[model samples]
Target: MSIAINLLPPEYRPRRHQLSRRVIIALVAGGLVLLAYVAFLGEMALAARRVAWLEGQLALYAPGAQQAAASNTALGDWRQKERELEQLVQNGRRWGQMLKTINEALPADAWLTGLEEDEGKGELTLTGGSTSLGGIGDFLTNLQGTNLWSMVSLQEVKGNGQSLTFTLRAVFPGAPGDAGKAGTIERAVEGK
Candidate 1:
Protein backbone atom coordinates (compact mmCIF):
# COMPACT_ATOMS: atom_id res chain seq x y z
CA MET A 1 0.00 0.00 0.00
CA SER A 2 1.04 3.49 -0.99
CA ILE A 3 -0.47 6.82 -0.09
CA ALA A 4 -2.57 8.66 -2.86
CA ILE A 5 -2.92 12.41 -3.25
CA ASN A 6 -5.47 14.60 -5.32
CA LEU A 7 -3.97 17.22 -7.58
CA LEU A 8 -7.19 19.01 -8.99
CA PRO A 9 -10.00 20.65 -7.09
CA PRO A 10 -13.56 19.16 -7.07
CA GLU A 11 -15.04 21.85 -9.36
CA TYR A 12 -12.43 21.17 -12.09
CA ARG A 13 -12.59 17.34 -12.00
CA PRO A 14 -13.70 15.30 -15.11
CA ARG A 15 -17.08 13.53 -14.81
CA ARG A 16 -17.53 9.78 -15.55
CA HIS A 17 -19.60 8.84 -18.68
CA GLN A 18 -21.90 5.76 -18.97
CA LEU A 19 -21.13 5.13 -22.72
CA SER A 20 -17.72 4.25 -24.24
CA ARG A 21 -16.27 5.56 -27.60
CA ARG A 22 -16.93 2.24 -29.40
CA VAL A 23 -20.57 2.15 -28.22
CA ILE A 24 -21.21 5.74 -29.32
CA ILE A 25 -19.73 5.01 -32.76
CA ALA A 26 -21.92 1.86 -33.10
CA LEU A 27 -25.10 3.82 -32.15
CA VAL A 28 -24.35 6.59 -34.73
CA ALA A 29 -23.73 4.00 -37.47
CA GLY A 30 -27.01 2.20 -36.69
CA GLY A 31 -28.97 5.52 -36.87
CA LEU A 32 -27.43 6.32 -40.27
CA VAL A 33 -28.35 2.82 -41.62
CA LEU A 34 -31.95 3.26 -40.41
CA LEU A 35 -32.21 6.68 -42.10
CA ALA A 36 -30.93 5.20 -45.42
CA TYR A 37 -33.48 2.35 -45.25
CA VAL A 38 -36.36 4.84 -44.71
CA ALA A 39 -35.17 6.94 -47.69
CA PHE A 40 -35.09 3.86 -49.92
CA LEU A 41 -38.65 2.93 -48.94
CA GLY A 42 -39.89 6.47 -49.72
CA GLU A 43 -38.30 6.37 -53.15
CA MET A 44 -39.89 3.00 -53.92
CA ALA A 45 -43.31 4.31 -52.92
CA LEU A 46 -42.98 7.34 -55.24
CA ALA A 47 -41.95 5.17 -58.18
CA ALA A 48 -44.89 2.84 -57.68
CA ARG A 49 -47.32 5.79 -57.60
CA ARG A 50 -45.91 7.14 -60.83
CA VAL A 51 -46.29 3.78 -62.56
CA ALA A 52 -49.92 3.48 -61.42
CA TRP A 53 -50.75 6.97 -62.76
CA LEU A 54 -49.21 6.17 -66.15
CA GLU A 55 -51.22 2.97 -66.42
CA GLY A 56 -54.44 4.86 -65.63
CA GLN A 57 -53.75 7.40 -68.36
CA LEU A 58 -53.03 4.68 -70.90
CA ALA A 59 -56.27 2.93 -70.08
CA LEU A 60 -58.26 6.15 -70.50
CA TYR A 61 -57.01 6.68 -74.08
CA ALA A 62 -56.93 3.04 -75.21
CA PRO A 63 -60.43 2.97 -76.69
CA GLY A 64 -59.90 6.07 -78.78
CA ALA A 65 -56.57 4.79 -80.02
CA GLN A 66 -58.15 1.53 -81.11
CA GLN A 67 -60.97 3.38 -82.84
CA ALA A 68 -58.53 5.59 -84.71
CA ALA A 69 -56.63 2.56 -85.96
CA ALA A 70 -59.87 0.98 -87.17
CA SER A 71 -60.83 4.20 -88.95
CA ASN A 72 -57.49 4.29 -90.72
CA THR A 73 -58.00 0.74 -91.97
CA ALA A 74 -61.52 1.60 -93.18
CA LEU A 75 -60.22 4.67 -94.98
CA GLY A 76 -57.66 2.57 -96.82
CA ASP A 77 -60.38 0.15 -97.93
CA TRP A 78 -62.57 3.00 -99.14
CA ARG A 79 -59.73 4.47 -101.17
CA GLN A 80 -59.12 1.11 -102.84
CA LYS A 81 -62.82 0.80 -103.73
CA GLU A 82 -62.85 4.32 -105.11
CA ARG A 83 -59.89 3.51 -107.36
CA GLU A 84 -61.63 0.38 -108.65
CA LEU A 85 -64.79 2.34 -109.41
CA GLU A 86 -62.80 4.95 -111.31
CA GLN A 87 -61.10 2.24 -113.38
CA LEU A 88 -64.48 0.70 -114.27
CA VAL A 89 -65.91 4.07 -115.28
CA GLN A 90 -62.91 4.77 -117.49
CA ASN A 91 -62.73 1.36 -119.22
CA GLY A 92 -66.47 0.87 -119.98
CA ARG A 93 -67.62 2.31 -123.36
CA ARG A 94 -71.02 3.94 -123.92
CA TRP A 95 -72.50 1.98 -126.85
CA GLY A 96 -75.98 3.41 -126.57
CA GLN A 97 -74.70 6.96 -126.97
CA MET A 98 -72.62 5.90 -129.99
CA LEU A 99 -75.62 4.23 -131.70
CA LYS A 100 -77.77 7.29 -131.00
CA THR A 101 -75.13 9.44 -132.65
CA ILE A 102 -75.22 7.20 -135.73
CA ASN A 103 -79.02 7.36 -135.90
CA GLU A 104 -78.99 11.13 -135.66
CA ALA A 105 -76.53 11.37 -138.58
CA LEU A 106 -78.54 9.04 -140.89
CA PRO A 107 -80.64 10.82 -143.51
CA ALA A 108 -84.46 10.36 -143.68
CA ASP A 109 -84.44 8.45 -146.99
CA ALA A 110 -81.22 6.50 -146.26
CA TRP A 111 -81.70 3.14 -144.46
CA LEU A 112 -78.95 1.06 -142.89
CA THR A 113 -78.74 -2.61 -143.96
CA GLY A 114 -75.90 -3.43 -141.58
CA LEU A 115 -73.86 -1.54 -138.96
CA GLU A 116 -70.72 -3.56 -138.31
CA GLU A 117 -68.19 -2.69 -135.56
CA ASP A 118 -64.67 -4.16 -135.35
CA GLU A 119 -63.73 -3.87 -131.68
CA GLY A 120 -60.13 -4.97 -132.17
CA LYS A 121 -59.51 -2.44 -134.97
CA GLY A 122 -61.92 0.13 -133.50
CA GLU A 123 -63.50 0.66 -136.92
CA LEU A 124 -67.10 1.19 -138.07
CA THR A 125 -68.55 -0.13 -141.40
CA LEU A 126 -71.87 1.45 -142.42
CA THR A 127 -73.64 -0.56 -145.14
CA GLY A 128 -76.80 1.21 -146.21
CA GLY A 129 -79.21 1.89 -149.15
CA SER A 130 -80.27 5.37 -150.18
CA THR A 131 -82.83 6.76 -152.67
CA SER A 132 -80.09 8.70 -154.50
CA LEU A 133 -76.30 9.06 -154.52
CA GLY A 134 -76.79 12.59 -153.24
CA GLY A 135 -78.54 11.15 -150.16
CA ILE A 136 -75.54 8.90 -149.47
CA GLY A 137 -73.23 11.89 -149.87
CA ASP A 138 -75.38 13.88 -147.46
CA PHE A 139 -75.22 11.04 -144.92
CA LEU A 140 -71.42 10.83 -145.19
CA THR A 141 -71.17 14.60 -144.84
CA ASN A 142 -73.30 14.60 -141.70
CA LEU A 143 -71.17 11.84 -140.15
CA GLN A 144 -67.94 13.68 -140.97
CA GLY A 145 -69.24 16.92 -139.46
CA THR A 146 -69.79 15.16 -136.08
CA ASN A 147 -66.91 14.58 -133.63
CA LEU A 148 -67.39 10.79 -133.59
CA TRP A 149 -65.04 9.76 -136.39
CA SER A 150 -61.43 10.65 -137.00
CA MET A 151 -61.61 9.43 -140.61
CA VAL A 152 -64.57 8.91 -143.02
CA SER A 153 -64.08 7.41 -146.48
CA LEU A 154 -66.51 5.98 -149.08
CA GLN A 155 -65.70 2.28 -149.54
CA GLU A 156 -68.06 1.50 -152.51
CA VAL A 157 -71.18 2.76 -154.33
CA LYS A 158 -73.36 0.39 -156.41
CA GLY A 159 -76.64 0.64 -158.29
CA ASN A 160 -77.99 3.58 -160.32
CA GLY A 161 -80.16 6.60 -159.39
CA GLN A 162 -82.84 4.84 -157.32
CA SER A 163 -82.09 2.02 -154.78
CA LEU A 164 -78.41 3.02 -154.55
CA THR A 165 -76.35 0.96 -152.09
CA PHE A 166 -73.28 2.43 -150.38
CA THR A 167 -70.62 1.27 -147.93
CA LEU A 168 -68.83 3.82 -145.73
CA ARG A 169 -65.77 3.07 -143.57
CA ALA A 170 -65.44 5.37 -140.58
CA VAL A 171 -62.75 5.21 -137.88
CA PHE A 172 -63.81 5.67 -134.27
CA PRO A 173 -62.37 8.89 -132.81
CA GLY A 174 -59.98 7.16 -130.41
CA ALA A 175 -58.82 4.43 -132.82
CA PRO A 176 -55.13 3.59 -133.01
CA GLY A 177 -52.92 4.87 -135.88
CA ASP A 178 -55.05 8.00 -136.32
CA ALA A 179 -54.44 11.67 -135.56
CA GLY A 180 -57.28 11.65 -132.99
CA LYS A 181 -56.56 11.30 -129.25
CA ALA A 182 -58.28 9.15 -126.64
CA GLY A 183 -60.26 10.94 -123.94
CA THR A 184 -63.15 10.61 -121.49
CA ILE A 185 -66.66 10.19 -122.89
CA GLU A 186 -67.63 13.69 -121.86
CA ARG A 187 -64.51 15.16 -123.43
CA ALA A 188 -65.12 13.23 -126.68
CA VAL A 189 -68.74 14.39 -126.79
CA GLU A 190 -67.63 17.97 -126.16
CA GLY A 191 -65.12 17.57 -129.06
CA LYS A 192 -62.28 18.71 -126.83
Candidate 2:
Protein backbone atom coordinates (compact mmCIF):
# COMPACT_ATOMS: atom_id res chain seq x y z
CA MET A 1 0.00 0.00 0.00
CA SER A 2 3.09 2.57 0.58
CA ILE A 3 5.65 1.89 -2.28
CA ALA A 4 5.66 5.33 -4.15
CA ILE A 5 9.25 6.81 -5.11
CA ASN A 6 10.07 10.58 -4.89
CA LEU A 7 12.07 12.01 -8.00
CA LEU A 8 14.12 15.26 -8.41
CA PRO A 9 12.85 18.20 -10.47
CA PRO A 10 14.06 18.64 -14.08
CA GLU A 11 15.92 21.87 -13.23
CA TYR A 12 17.85 20.12 -10.41
CA ARG A 13 18.82 17.33 -12.81
CA PRO A 14 20.31 19.86 -15.26
CA ARG A 15 22.26 21.55 -12.42
CA ARG A 16 24.12 18.32 -11.77
CA HIS A 17 25.20 18.16 -15.42
CA GLN A 18 26.41 21.75 -15.26
CA LEU A 19 28.46 20.98 -12.12
CA SER A 20 30.16 18.11 -13.95
CA ARG A 21 31.21 20.45 -16.82
CA ARG A 22 32.61 23.01 -14.35
CA VAL A 23 34.76 20.35 -12.62
CA ILE A 24 36.18 19.22 -16.01
CA ILE A 25 37.02 22.84 -16.90
CA ALA A 26 38.78 23.37 -13.54
CA LEU A 27 40.89 20.18 -14.08
CA VAL A 28 42.00 21.32 -17.57
CA ALA A 29 43.04 24.75 -16.20
CA GLY A 30 45.12 23.10 -13.46
CA GLY A 31 46.89 20.89 -16.06
CA LEU A 32 47.73 23.97 -18.18
CA VAL A 33 49.28 25.68 -15.12
CA LEU A 34 51.48 22.65 -14.43
CA LEU A 35 52.70 22.56 -18.08
CA ALA A 36 53.54 26.29 -17.95
CA TYR A 37 55.61 25.78 -14.75
CA VAL A 38 57.64 22.98 -16.43
CA ALA A 39 58.23 25.13 -19.49
CA PHE A 40 59.42 28.01 -17.31
CA LEU A 41 61.94 25.69 -15.58
CA GLY A 42 63.27 24.54 -18.96
CA GLU A 43 63.72 28.18 -20.07
CA MET A 44 65.63 28.93 -16.87
CA ALA A 45 67.95 26.00 -17.49
CA LEU A 46 68.72 27.16 -21.06
CA ALA A 47 69.40 30.68 -19.89
CA ALA A 48 71.87 29.41 -17.29
CA ARG A 49 73.73 27.42 -19.95
CA ARG A 50 74.00 30.49 -22.16
CA VAL A 51 75.47 32.53 -19.31
CA ALA A 52 78.03 29.82 -18.52
CA TRP A 53 79.12 29.56 -22.16
CA LEU A 54 79.66 33.30 -22.39
CA GLU A 55 81.73 33.26 -19.21
CA GLY A 56 83.90 30.47 -20.55
CA GLN A 57 84.59 32.40 -23.74
CA LEU A 58 85.72 35.40 -21.75
CA ALA A 59 88.07 33.30 -19.69
CA LEU A 60 89.66 31.79 -22.77
CA TYR A 61 90.40 35.15 -24.36
CA ALA A 62 91.32 37.20 -21.29
CA PRO A 63 95.05 36.36 -21.06
CA GLY A 64 95.84 36.82 -24.73
CA ALA A 65 93.91 40.11 -24.86
CA GLN A 66 95.93 41.52 -21.98
CA GLN A 67 99.24 40.36 -23.53
CA ALA A 68 98.41 41.92 -26.88
CA ALA A 69 97.57 45.27 -25.29
CA ALA A 70 100.85 45.34 -23.34
CA SER A 71 102.89 44.39 -26.40
CA ASN A 72 101.33 47.16 -28.48
CA THR A 73 102.18 49.80 -25.89
CA ALA A 74 105.80 48.64 -25.52
CA LEU A 75 106.32 48.49 -29.27
CA GLY A 76 105.06 52.04 -29.68
CA ASP A 77 107.46 53.39 -27.03
CA TRP A 78 110.44 51.56 -28.52
CA ARG A 79 109.66 52.87 -31.99
CA GLN A 80 109.58 56.46 -30.75
CA LYS A 81 112.93 56.11 -28.99
CA GLU A 82 114.53 54.53 -32.07
CA ARG A 83 113.42 57.42 -34.26
CA GLU A 84 114.87 59.97 -31.88
CA LEU A 85 118.18 58.13 -31.72
CA GLU A 86 118.34 57.88 -35.50
CA GLN A 87 117.92 61.64 -35.83
CA LEU A 88 120.74 62.26 -33.38
CA VAL A 89 123.07 59.96 -35.29
CA GLN A 90 122.11 61.38 -38.69
CA ASN A 91 122.92 64.94 -37.59
CA GLY A 92 126.59 63.83 -37.59
CA ARG A 93 127.05 64.94 -34.03
CA ARG A 94 127.57 61.51 -32.48
CA TRP A 95 130.44 59.87 -34.30
CA GLY A 96 130.42 56.25 -33.10
CA GLN A 97 133.52 55.10 -35.02
CA MET A 98 136.18 57.70 -34.19
CA LEU A 99 137.94 56.30 -31.13
CA LYS A 100 138.66 52.85 -32.56
CA THR A 101 140.20 54.23 -35.75
CA ILE A 102 142.58 56.43 -33.78
CA ASN A 103 143.58 53.55 -31.54
CA GLU A 104 144.38 51.45 -34.63
CA ALA A 105 146.92 53.98 -35.85
CA LEU A 106 148.67 54.59 -32.54
CA PRO A 107 152.44 53.94 -32.46
CA ALA A 108 153.69 51.15 -30.18
CA ASP A 109 155.85 53.43 -28.07
CA ALA A 110 153.43 56.45 -27.96
CA TRP A 111 151.08 56.48 -24.97
CA LEU A 112 148.00 58.67 -24.92
CA THR A 113 147.48 60.48 -21.64
CA GLY A 114 144.08 61.88 -22.68
CA LEU A 115 141.97 60.67 -25.55
CA GLU A 116 138.38 61.67 -26.06
CA GLU A 117 135.77 61.81 -28.82
CA ASP A 118 132.74 64.04 -28.27
CA GLU A 119 130.07 65.14 -30.73
CA GLY A 120 132.32 64.39 -33.75
CA LYS A 121 135.24 66.25 -32.18
CA GLY A 122 138.37 64.31 -31.25
CA GLU A 123 141.10 65.43 -28.88
CA LEU A 124 144.29 63.57 -28.09
CA THR A 125 147.17 64.20 -25.69
CA LEU A 126 150.29 62.06 -26.10
CA THR A 127 153.53 61.90 -24.04
CA GLY A 128 156.61 59.93 -25.07
CA GLY A 129 160.38 60.47 -25.46
CA SER A 130 160.96 59.52 -29.08
CA THR A 131 164.21 57.84 -30.06
CA SER A 132 164.79 60.75 -32.43
CA LEU A 133 162.94 63.88 -33.62
CA GLY A 134 162.48 62.20 -37.01
CA GLY A 135 160.22 59.48 -35.52
CA ILE A 136 157.88 62.05 -33.98
CA GLY A 137 157.79 64.03 -37.21
CA ASP A 138 156.97 60.94 -39.23
CA PHE A 139 154.06 60.00 -36.95
CA LEU A 140 152.56 63.49 -37.15
CA THR A 141 152.91 63.56 -40.92
CA ASN A 142 151.14 60.22 -41.33
CA LEU A 143 148.20 61.23 -39.09
CA GLN A 144 147.66 64.38 -41.22
CA GLY A 145 147.33 62.33 -44.39
CA THR A 146 144.67 59.89 -43.13
CA ASN A 147 141.21 60.46 -44.65
CA LEU A 148 139.46 59.18 -41.50
CA TRP A 149 140.31 62.52 -39.89
CA SER A 150 139.59 66.14 -40.85
CA MET A 151 140.98 69.42 -39.52
CA VAL A 152 144.01 67.59 -38.19
CA SER A 153 145.82 70.37 -36.36
CA LEU A 154 148.23 70.28 -33.49
CA GLN A 155 147.11 72.16 -30.35
CA GLU A 156 150.28 72.53 -28.25
CA VAL A 157 153.70 70.98 -27.69
CA LYS A 158 155.71 71.18 -24.46
CA GLY A 159 158.98 69.45 -23.74
CA ASN A 160 161.48 69.64 -20.82
CA GLY A 161 164.36 69.35 -23.31
CA GLN A 162 164.07 65.53 -23.10
CA SER A 163 160.44 64.54 -22.49
CA LEU A 164 157.69 65.50 -25.03
CA THR A 165 154.00 66.37 -24.67
CA PHE A 166 151.75 66.94 -27.71
CA THR A 167 148.02 67.83 -27.99
CA LEU A 168 145.92 67.61 -31.15
CA ARG A 169 142.31 68.00 -32.31
CA ALA A 170 140.61 66.40 -35.30
CA VAL A 171 137.14 65.98 -36.81
CA PHE A 172 135.72 62.48 -37.04
CA PRO A 173 134.67 61.55 -40.59
CA GLY A 174 132.92 58.37 -39.45
CA ALA A 175 133.99 55.12 -41.03
CA PRO A 176 133.11 54.05 -44.57
CA GLY A 177 133.46 50.41 -43.52
CA ASP A 178 130.60 50.63 -40.99
CA ALA A 179 127.76 51.07 -43.50
CA GLY A 180 126.84 47.38 -43.58
CA LYS A 181 127.05 47.03 -39.79
CA ALA A 182 124.78 50.02 -39.31
CA GLY A 183 122.20 48.52 -41.66
CA THR A 184 122.29 45.22 -39.80
CA ILE A 185 121.71 46.94 -36.45
CA GLU A 186 118.77 48.87 -37.85
CA ARG A 187 117.17 45.73 -39.22
CA ALA A 188 117.58 43.79 -35.98
CA VAL A 189 116.03 46.55 -33.91
CA GLU A 190 113.00 46.87 -36.20
CA GLY A 191 112.38 43.15 -36.48
CA LYS A 192 110.29 42.92 -33.30
Candidate 3:
Protein backbone atom coordinates (compact mmCIF):
# COMPACT_ATOMS: atom_id res chain seq x y z
CA MET A 1 0.00 0.00 0.00
CA SER A 2 1.31 3.50 -0.98
CA ILE A 3 1.12 6.23 1.78
CA ALA A 4 0.36 9.75 0.46
CA ILE A 5 2.01 12.77 2.24
CA ASN A 6 0.30 16.21 1.84
CA LEU A 7 2.56 19.27 1.44
CA LEU A 8 0.99 22.77 2.17
CA PRO A 9 2.34 26.02 0.82
CA PRO A 10 4.89 27.59 3.32
CA GLU A 11 2.78 30.73 3.87
CA TYR A 12 -0.29 28.71 5.01
CA ARG A 13 1.61 26.41 7.38
CA PRO A 14 1.94 27.12 11.18
CA ARG A 15 5.32 28.68 12.22
CA ARG A 16 6.91 26.67 15.03
CA HIS A 17 9.61 29.35 15.60
CA GLN A 18 7.14 32.02 16.94
CA LEU A 19 6.15 31.36 20.56
CA SER A 20 2.95 32.52 22.52
CA ARG A 21 4.40 35.79 23.85
CA ARG A 22 1.64 36.79 26.29
CA VAL A 23 1.39 33.28 27.77
CA ILE A 24 5.16 33.20 28.41
CA ILE A 25 5.01 36.69 29.93
CA ALA A 26 2.11 35.66 32.17
CA LEU A 27 3.92 32.48 33.29
CA VAL A 28 7.13 34.40 34.13
CA ALA A 29 5.13 37.04 36.05
CA GLY A 30 3.27 34.34 37.98
CA GLY A 31 6.49 32.58 38.90
CA LEU A 32 8.08 35.91 40.02
CA VAL A 33 5.02 36.76 42.20
CA LEU A 34 5.02 33.30 43.79
CA LEU A 35 8.74 33.56 44.55
CA ALA A 36 8.27 37.06 45.99
CA TYR A 37 5.43 35.84 48.22
CA VAL A 38 7.51 32.93 49.45
CA ALA A 39 10.44 35.27 50.20
CA PHE A 40 8.15 37.66 52.16
CA LEU A 41 6.73 34.78 54.26
CA GLY A 42 10.20 33.46 55.03
CA GLU A 43 11.33 36.89 56.27
CA MET A 44 8.26 37.20 58.51
CA ALA A 45 8.82 33.68 59.94
CA LEU A 46 12.46 34.49 60.69
CA ALA A 47 11.48 37.68 62.56
CA ALA A 48 8.89 35.74 64.58
CA ARG A 49 11.49 33.14 65.49
CA ARG A 50 13.90 35.84 66.73
CA VAL A 51 11.21 37.34 68.95
CA ALA A 52 10.33 33.93 70.41
CA TRP A 53 13.99 33.25 71.23
CA LEU A 54 14.29 36.56 73.10
CA GLU A 55 11.09 35.86 75.05
CA GLY A 56 12.33 32.40 75.98
CA GLN A 57 15.60 33.80 77.33
CA LEU A 58 13.74 36.34 79.46
CA ALA A 59 11.37 33.65 80.79
CA LEU A 60 14.31 31.49 81.87
CA TYR A 61 15.79 34.35 83.97
CA ALA A 62 12.49 35.44 85.57
CA PRO A 63 12.62 32.80 88.30
CA GLY A 64 16.17 33.81 89.23
CA ALA A 65 15.11 37.41 89.72
CA GLN A 66 12.22 36.35 91.94
CA GLN A 67 14.51 34.16 94.05
CA ALA A 68 17.01 37.01 94.55
CA ALA A 69 14.22 39.34 95.69
CA ALA A 70 12.93 36.75 98.14
CA SER A 71 16.43 36.21 99.50
CA ASN A 72 16.85 39.94 100.09
CA THR A 73 13.61 40.09 102.07
CA ALA A 74 14.66 37.11 104.17
CA LEU A 75 18.07 38.64 104.86
CA GLY A 76 16.51 41.91 105.94
CA ASP A 77 14.18 40.13 108.37
CA TRP A 78 17.05 38.13 109.86
CA ARG A 79 19.14 41.29 110.34
CA GLN A 80 16.31 42.93 112.30
CA LYS A 81 15.98 39.89 114.54
CA GLU A 82 19.71 39.86 115.19
CA ARG A 83 19.67 43.55 116.17
CA GLU A 84 16.82 42.95 118.63
CA LEU A 85 18.67 40.03 120.20
CA GLU A 86 21.85 42.10 120.57
CA GLN A 87 19.93 44.89 122.31
CA LEU A 88 18.47 42.40 124.79
CA VAL A 89 21.89 40.96 125.56
CA GLN A 90 23.40 44.42 126.13
CA ASN A 91 20.54 45.41 128.46
CA GLY A 92 20.97 42.20 130.45
CA ARG A 93 24.69 42.85 130.95
CA ARG A 94 24.02 46.40 132.09
CA TRP A 95 21.48 45.15 134.64
CA GLY A 96 23.91 42.53 135.95
CA GLN A 97 26.60 45.16 136.58
CA MET A 98 24.09 47.40 138.38
CA LEU A 99 23.10 44.56 140.71
CA LYS A 100 26.72 43.78 141.53
CA THR A 101 27.44 47.42 142.31
CA ILE A 102 24.37 47.64 144.59
CA ASN A 103 25.36 44.49 146.49
CA GLU A 104 28.88 45.84 147.17
CA ALA A 105 27.50 49.19 148.38
CA LEU A 106 24.96 47.74 150.87
CA PRO A 107 25.81 47.35 154.57
CA ALA A 108 26.08 43.92 156.20
CA ASP A 109 22.94 44.39 158.35
CA ALA A 110 20.82 45.92 155.57
CA TRP A 111 19.22 43.54 153.00
CA LEU A 112 17.72 44.34 149.64
CA THR A 113 14.32 42.77 148.93
CA GLY A 114 13.98 44.08 145.39
CA LEU A 115 16.44 45.54 142.90
CA GLU A 116 14.57 46.41 139.69
CA GLU A 117 16.09 47.70 136.50
CA ASP A 118 13.88 49.49 134.01
CA GLU A 119 15.86 49.30 130.79
CA GLY A 120 13.49 51.45 128.79
CA LYS A 121 13.83 54.39 131.20
CA GLY A 122 17.43 53.51 132.09
CA GLU A 123 16.79 53.72 135.85
CA LEU A 124 17.25 51.39 138.83
CA THR A 125 14.60 51.16 141.58
CA LEU A 126 15.96 50.08 144.97
CA THR A 127 13.52 48.81 147.61
CA GLY A 128 14.99 47.54 150.92
CA GLY A 129 14.25 47.21 154.67
CA SER A 130 16.80 47.41 157.43
CA THR A 131 16.62 46.21 161.06
CA SER A 132 17.89 49.53 162.52
CA LEU A 133 17.11 53.12 161.58
CA GLY A 134 20.72 54.17 162.30
CA GLY A 135 21.94 51.59 159.77
CA ILE A 136 19.55 53.01 157.14
CA GLY A 137 20.72 56.56 157.89
CA ASP A 138 24.35 55.48 157.62
CA PHE A 139 23.59 53.72 154.31
CA LEU A 140 22.07 56.91 152.91
CA THR A 141 25.02 58.94 154.09
CA ASN A 142 27.46 56.56 152.43
CA LEU A 143 25.45 56.51 149.18
CA GLN A 144 25.32 60.32 149.10
CA GLY A 145 29.03 60.66 149.70
CA THR A 146 29.83 58.65 146.56
CA ASN A 147 30.53 60.47 143.24
CA LEU A 148 29.35 57.54 141.07
CA TRP A 149 25.70 58.56 141.58
CA SER A 150 24.04 61.69 140.29
CA MET A 151 20.60 62.83 141.56
CA VAL A 152 20.60 60.22 144.35
CA SER A 153 17.25 61.19 145.89
CA LEU A 154 15.62 59.52 148.87
CA GLN A 155 12.12 59.22 147.36
CA GLU A 156 10.37 57.68 150.40
CA VAL A 157 11.14 56.56 153.99
CA LYS A 158 8.89 54.63 156.45
CA GLY A 159 9.77 53.46 159.94
CA ASN A 160 8.32 51.61 162.96
CA GLY A 161 10.86 53.08 165.43
CA GLN A 162 12.96 49.87 165.48
CA SER A 163 13.10 49.13 161.70
CA LEU A 164 12.88 51.20 158.49
CA THR A 165 11.97 50.79 154.84
CA PHE A 166 13.47 53.02 152.14
CA THR A 167 12.82 53.70 148.46
CA LEU A 168 15.67 55.39 146.58
CA ARG A 169 16.26 56.26 142.89
CA ALA A 170 19.66 56.91 141.35
CA VAL A 171 21.34 56.88 137.97
CA PHE A 172 24.00 54.29 137.58
CA PRO A 173 27.40 55.15 135.93
CA GLY A 174 26.68 58.67 137.18
CA ALA A 175 24.36 61.70 137.23
CA PRO A 176 23.38 63.19 133.82
CA GLY A 177 24.25 66.66 132.40
CA ASP A 178 27.78 67.82 131.57
CA ALA A 179 28.82 65.20 134.18
CA GLY A 180 27.21 62.54 132.00
CA LYS A 181 30.83 61.99 131.07
CA ALA A 182 31.55 58.81 133.06
CA GLY A 183 34.85 58.57 134.86
CA THR A 184 36.06 55.81 137.18
CA ILE A 185 33.44 53.74 139.07
CA GLU A 186 35.75 51.85 141.46
CA ARG A 187 37.30 55.08 142.73
CA ALA A 188 33.90 56.73 143.42
CA VAL A 189 32.38 53.71 145.21
CA GLU A 190 35.58 53.33 147.32
CA GLY A 191 35.68 57.00 148.43
CA LYS A 192 36.36 57.92 152.12
TM-score-better candidate, 2 vs 3: 3
Better of 1 and 2 by TM-score: 1
Tell me the spans in candidate 1 whose CA falls farther than 4 Å from its real position.
1-89, 180-192
TM, every model: 0.46, 0.42, 0.52
lDDT per residue for candidate 2 within 160-188, as digits (tens), equals: 78656666555444533323342332243
Ranking by lDDT: 1, 3, 2
Q: Rank the candidates by TM-score, best first.
A: 3, 1, 2
Off by over 4 Å in 2: 1-62, 77-109, 120-134, 174-192
What clash pairs does model 3 have? none
lDDT tens digits by residue: candidate 1, 15-114: 7768988999999999999999999999999999999999999999999999999999999999999999998688545778978988998989898999
Could you tell me the C-alpha RMSD of candidate 2 in Å?
13.3
Q: Is candidate 1 or candidate 3 better by TM-score?
A: 3
* Candidate 3 C-alpha lDDT tens digits along 27-138: 9999999999999999999999999999999899999999999999999999999999998886444545656666777887787777676655555668898887666656
TM-score of model number 3: 0.52
Provide the clash count, candidate 3: 0
lDDT of each: 0.81, 0.60, 0.70
